[model samples]
Target chain A: LAKTTQPISMDSYEGQEVNITCSHNNIATNDYITWYQQFPSQGPRFIIQGYKTKVTNEVASLFIPADRKSSTLSLPRVSLSDTAVYYCLVFSGNTPLVFGKGTRLSVIA
Target chain B: DAMVIQNPRYQVTQFGKPVTLSCSQTLNHNVMYWYQQKSSQAPKLLFHYYDKDFNNEADTPDNFQSRRPNTSFCFLDIRSPGLGDAAMYLCATSRATGGYGYTFGSGTRLTVV
Candidate 1:
């Protein structure tokens, strides 16, 4: 399993774009970067995933560089409801995932 | 819509008492996972069942056991609940190894008294 590093917390205003970056220098060849958003008392929700380059979804976008050592999750036009703990995971075949503390994004008014 | 479902939503148990938390999925996914999430912490994987084969995490305690009667149902048994064991237990499922789009249940909040 690959370990990920992210900011402990971030503060952003509503209607602003928030980008959370994760670094996994030891990412393996078959590893895919996945992001999840978890609200208080709720299970983590899948936001976006990408192997390389950029992938966009109805909720968020994931950008991965050629190096594959790092990835970023971009949330557009944030609202107070967007405040949550964002996790970046390096997923591989059948391996149990390990989540770090994650980046807690606080969308302030 | 098809989804993962956790029963009771909340549970209160006495210290040192045994309790069971259950999960069922209508998605019919091949893999079922159990995770423990404490307040302000990340979800920790306890174990998972792929079909009938159970996989336990290296650091999981013996007190925490799981049983999967079939594909649709999985249960987590805490042999003796402790105050420290109070947390949210989440159940999830995936189609296969290296699978995406995992479906997670709302979870059961366990409170140890």
Candidate 2:
């Protein structure tokens, strides 16, 4: 399992775009980068995933550089409801995932 | 809405007493996982069931055990609860191995008194 590093916390205002970056320096060839959003007392929900390049969805966009050492999750028009912890996971095939301490994003209205 | 479900959103148990948390999923996924999350910490993998086969994490305490009688349902059993066992227990399911983000239940907050 590759260890991922993210900011401890972040602050953003409503209607603003918030981008949380994650670093996974030891990412492997078969490793896939995925992100999840977890609200207080709730399970983490899948946000977006990518092998390389950029992928966009209704909720967020994932951008991965060619090196694949890191990725970013971009949330558009943030709202107070979006305040939650965001996790970045690096998993190769058939391996159990290690959930690192994620970035806690607080959206202020 | 075929989703993951965890029962008794909150549970209170006395120290050294055994407690069980239930998880059921309508998605019928092949994999089920249990995670323990303490206050202000990341969710730690306790164990998971892959088609009736149980796998426990290396650091998971002996007190933590799991049973998967069949697909779509799994249980986390803490043999003897300690004060440190009080935390949120989360249940999730996925079709693939850790690549796809699994569906998570709201979690059961266990309080050991």
Candidate 3:
């Protein structure tokens, strides 16, 4: 397990793009960068994950640099419903994952 | 499809009383995990069971115990509920697919009164 650092909070207007970056300088070689979204009264949801380079899904995109020291979660065309606390975690292939304080994204209308 | 389901979304237990939280999953994942989250805080992993092998976190209190009777169901038992234990308990399941696409339940909100 590796410790991750992310912004405390971020705000964006609806239909805008929101980018939340996380830094894990001590990230292990086998560690993968993963992001999760947690809404009010609900469990954290898996948003996106990537080992290296860039990975895109229908929901979001995970961008990893060559160093893998940091990663960014890009949410396009944000909506009010997309507002939530986003977590960035680092974990090996088989181990219990840890959740950090995470960056809270507020998509305002 | 309700991949992961937790029973009694809201639970109220008296101080020092024992309570059990139940979780079931339809994904047929080999790994089941339990997490505790306080209000407006990040979730903390308490433990996980991978194919019936119980693995608890180093700092998790002994008061909190978990049992996995079968493949699809797991239980978290609190021997003595305290006010500090009031929070959301989330149950999540994942396969050994070498990814973090773990499916989580809605979570059980435990209120200690």
lDDT of each: 0.92, 0.92, 0.92
For every candidate in turn, the CA RMSD to the true structure comes to 0.9, 0.8, 1.1
Per-residue CA lDDT of model 2 for A37-93, tens digit only, reads 999989889899899999999999999999999999999999999999999999987
Ranking by DockQ: 2, 1, 3
Compute DockQ for each candidate against the true complex: 0.69, 0.84, 0.66
| TM-scores of the candidates in the order shown | 0.98, 0.98, 0.97
- Runs in model 2 deviating more than 4 A are none
Cα error, candidate 2, residue A40 (Å): 0.6
Candidate 2 lDDT, B1-84, residue by residue in tens: 999999989999999999999999999899999999999999999988888778888899999999998897898999999999
lDDT of 3 at A86: 95
Better of 2 and 3 by DockQ: 2
- Ranking of predictions according to lDDT: 2, 3, 1
lDDT tens digits by residue: candidate 1, B59-82? 999999999999999999999999
- For model 3, what is the C-alpha lDDT against the true structure? 0.92
CAPRI verdict on model 2?
Answer: high
Fnat of candidates, each listed? 0.61, 0.90, 0.63
The number of the candidate with the highest DockQ is 2
